[model samples]
Target chain A: MRFGVVVFPGSNCDRDCYHVIKEVMEEPVEYIWHKEKSLSGFDALILPGGFSYGDYLRTGAIARFSPIMPAVMDFAQAGGLVLGICNGFQILLEAGLLPGAMLRNSSLKFICQPVFLKIQRNDTPFSNKFKSMQVVKIPIAHGEGNYYCDPRTLQEMKDNGQILFTYCSADGEETMEYNPNGSLANIAGIMNGKGNVLGMMPHPERYSEDILGGRDGFNIFASMINWLKGVG
Target chain B: MLKANIYVTLKNGVLDPQGEAVKKSLKILDFGQVNQVRIGKFIEVWLESRDQAAAIKELEEMSDKLLANPVIEDYRVEIVEVNQS
Candidate 1:
């Protein structure tokens, strides 16, 4: 599968994401500038994490207004697969492609460490490779990853199995202290209504190779490849 | 001309860590009576139309689509007529 990674100003993780997709996954990958308006040729898009627009105003706030966002919105609306990691997730929220908002970390500090995430729903294209309730280790580095939503929407997400992943301990056990950002219900990721768009705070691309850490995250992209193959 | 003031705030039940931090600072400074604080964003938008009704509708759409996250934020928009000499 061909992958297109969006490169915005202040995007620090674009290279890492590109390396993993091109080398580890053995998929053809290319960098797309944030100002470019067309995404017609790419099969999938990845918005990597970083301090986009220097996290000005708010994380992802200014980046949402970039010229490329209109095309990204159109891509996702047309059922194209889009994966947003870390600040990418925040940008998705700011762009209104995903629900909920990110707030400052409850601890009020930039947290950088390997975090465990429990897969809550594996039915979507993003997590179809994992079993429900399976735990995956990935690194999370951000200051505004706390997810907040109203009770009604939260209940709807729970009823619809939309909650994709939750923060957990390294051993896969759920714990309060391991909840790094104080995210409501320990939410680490979510999917859009159609399940084609995914926004997660953890960096799955960073851990896709065994050399960097583990290969658990490799399975996520692999699942996407398999899905594309099945469709094609 | 029309003037609109928008107040955006995190809805009740959602944690406001920034506001919490400021509240903690207030207590640290010996303001013991302060119990709670909530942080919000304010924006003033000026439009060329003098029609209050049209301006309110347009600003509301802007707020819903971009200015606020309805999932966690509540916004109030007030419209007023601007005087021109």
Candidate 2:
């Protein structure tokens, strides 16, 4: 599958994401500038991490209005796959493509470390490569990764099975101590109601290779690859 | 010209770690009588229009769509008129 990684000014992880897909995964990938107006030919879009727009005026507030967003929104609305990691997750929430909003880490500190994750669903393209309840280690680096939603939205997401991953122990136990940012319900990742778009705080691309001290994240990219092959 | 000064803050019931830290510092500085302390942002938006009502409406729209994330924040707008020197 062809992947397009959107690069906004101040996005530090665009190159990392591009390398993982192009060199490691052997998949076709291209850098999509923030000003580019089209997502016409890509099978999937990625909003990688970093302090976009220097995290000014809120983390994703300014980046949300970049020229490429309308195209990104159009693509996702048409059932196209969009995966937002880290600050990209912030942008997705700001753009209303995904539910909820991100808040400052409850501890009020920038956290950068590997944490265990419990996969909650495997039917979606983003997690199909993992078995239900599978545990994986991924790194999260951000100062404002806390996720918040109203009671109604939270209930709706729960009922719709939109939640995809939660911070958990190495043995797959979900608990408060494992939550790095005090995200509501230990939520580390979630997809849209339709399950086509996903926003997660953890950085999968950072841990997709053995050189990075972990390889569990490789399946996340593999899942999308297989999903595209099946549908395409 | 009409100026809209907006204050954005986390909504009630949401935890504010930064505010708590500031409150702790204030107490340590001998201000223990303080019952509460909450921190927020103040934004100034200047409008080049004579119609105060229109400016208020527009500022309200701006606050709702971009200035604040309703899920976690609440924003208030006030219109101030500035006199040119």
lDDT of candidates 1 onward, in order: 0.88, 0.90
User: So what's the TM-score on candidate 1?
Assistant: 0.88
- Candidate 2, residues B7-66: lDDT per residue as tens digits? 999899877778887888899999989767788889998888878788889999998888
lDDT of 1 at B64: 85
* lDDT of residue B35 for candidate 2: 65
Highest-scoring model, DockQ: 2
Summing lDDT over every window of 10 consecutive residues in candidate 1 chain A, give the lowest-scoring window.
A223-232
Candidate 2 CAPRI category? medium
The i-RMS of every model, in angstroms, reads 1.9, 1.1
Cα deviation of A229 in candidate 1 (Å)? 1.5
Each candidate's TM vs. the true structure? 0.88, 0.97
Q: Determine which window of 10 residues in candidate 2 chain A has minimal summed lDDT.
A: A223-232
